[model samples]
Target: MMHHLGKVALPVYFWLFVTWLFLPLFVMAAMGFRDSNFVAFPIQSWTTDWYQSVLDDREILASLWVSLQVAVLSTILGLGIGTPMAFMVARFHGVWRAILITIIVMPAFIPIVVSAIALRMFIGNFGIQTGLVAIAFGHAVSSVPFVVVMLLTRLNSMSPNLADAARDLGADEFIIFFRVVLPYLSPALFGAFMFCMLLSFEDFTRSFFLGSFDPTFPVLLFARLRFGFDPGLAAISTLVLVATIALGIYAERFTRKRTAPAKQGRLAASGDDKNV
Candidate 1:
């Protein structure tokens, strides 16, 4: 009886949750079509002129370029550093492992504003000025913890026997890692990459403190909002939402492809053994 009640209630709860989550987004999307100059609750009529204006704005374009550079660079650096660290933590058993993992994850707990301020002070002392490089470094620091956690979860789910079998077959360490481990990890890596990209793109506090001349997307958006809310901002947000959803779908497909074949192969082999 309880199970049936839960099943019936689940759909209603899910719809409520979805509506709660997407209400603001829907409002923003609606505002994107407003024909008026000022931002208003009830949009009069549909118009795409604001989107066109945003497209023609040189500052927005430049800010987007800067944001793209920072997000890409930060994701690359985070992946390069975090993946190995995750593997070590997942596979190794030692006292130092926990300590090291905790240290790697500490950055996530640190407030972004505090981290940004510390970086600014540290870099200033070394005569390193704020710009794209500073922003990239700050983003990398913040993003690496997430990458580590995601990759660690993936690594933990993998069977230890697979790695041992690879070693017994005389595969070298590099080849075993690349062939046996990386394929299973691709989905997680893609997820981490997308998360890092979104975080870097949407960051504002760090950018405000560390961004000197080159501002990121969020920083630019904040500046635009200060002047007054524009319909173009809504359009840009809608684009971001669509892109994120598309990336999530692609990652899900990739994960299914990677795991499905192995399961099928096992089932086929089991059936063959039974026939014998």
Candidate 2:
């Protein structure tokens, strides 16, 4: 009786928690469509004017362009640095490897605000005015740790025998890595890229500190929100939410497609050996 009750309670609690988390998002989305200049709960009438207004806002567009440049550059740079570090950490076993991984991931555990402040002070001393380059550098620093951790986890779970098999087949080190390890790491790489992109997009504290001459999207959004409530802000937020959801779905599909063949190949190999 107790076991059955516990099983029933688990799903009920899960649904409740899910609802709790998404309720506010739903509310905000609805408010975005409200036919009013100011954001108000329990929207009076539905209209798309706010979204149109946001689309026409020049400052918002410029901020979005700045954000896109930063996010893309930062994610690319993080992947370049993080992928090799992840491979090393996953493939090698040594005291130095562990120490290196620890050092690489240490920045992630630090408070974002603290890291931002430190970056601000450092950049200030160099007389580097805050702008696109500063934002990209700050975002890359913050996101690399996440990419390394995610890729390392994926690499560790992969079978080392793949590399060994390639070597046994007379493949050189570079060829074996490119043919074997690269395919295996594809899903994790895509996931890390998406994560880094999102981190760069939604970052507020780091952008606030590192941004001076031009602001990123989030920084601009914050500045707009400080003056007064705008329904257009809600519209922008909703658009961002929808974009994030779409990207998440796309990433899932990409990962599944990349990994499915590897899993099926393993199964087929086991079946062949059994038949033999």
Please list the residue runs of candidate 2 whose C-alpha ends up more than 4 Å from where it truly belongs after superposition: 124-127, 159-161, 164-170, 264-276
- How much is the lDDT of residue 234 in candidate 1? 88
Residue-level error in angstroms, candidate 1, position 63: 1.2
Residues 1-276, candidate 2: write the lDDT tens digits: 889778998889999999999998888888889997777667778999998889998998899888999999889888998888787777567988788878988888889899988888888888887877788889989888888888887676566577788899999999987888877788889988998898898888888988876888889888888898777888888898899889978987987787678666655534433322
Backbone collisions counted per model: 0, 0
How many angstroms is residue 262 displaced in model 1 relative to the true structure, after the best TM-score fit? 5.0
**lDDT of the structure predicted as candidate 2:** 0.84
Clashing pairs in 2: none
- Report the Cα lDDT for residue 224, model 1: 77
Cα deviation of 162, candidate 2, in Å: 3.6
lDDT of each: 0.81, 0.84
RMSD (CA, angstroms), candidate 1: 4.3
Q: What TM-score does each of the candidates earn?
A: 0.84, 0.87
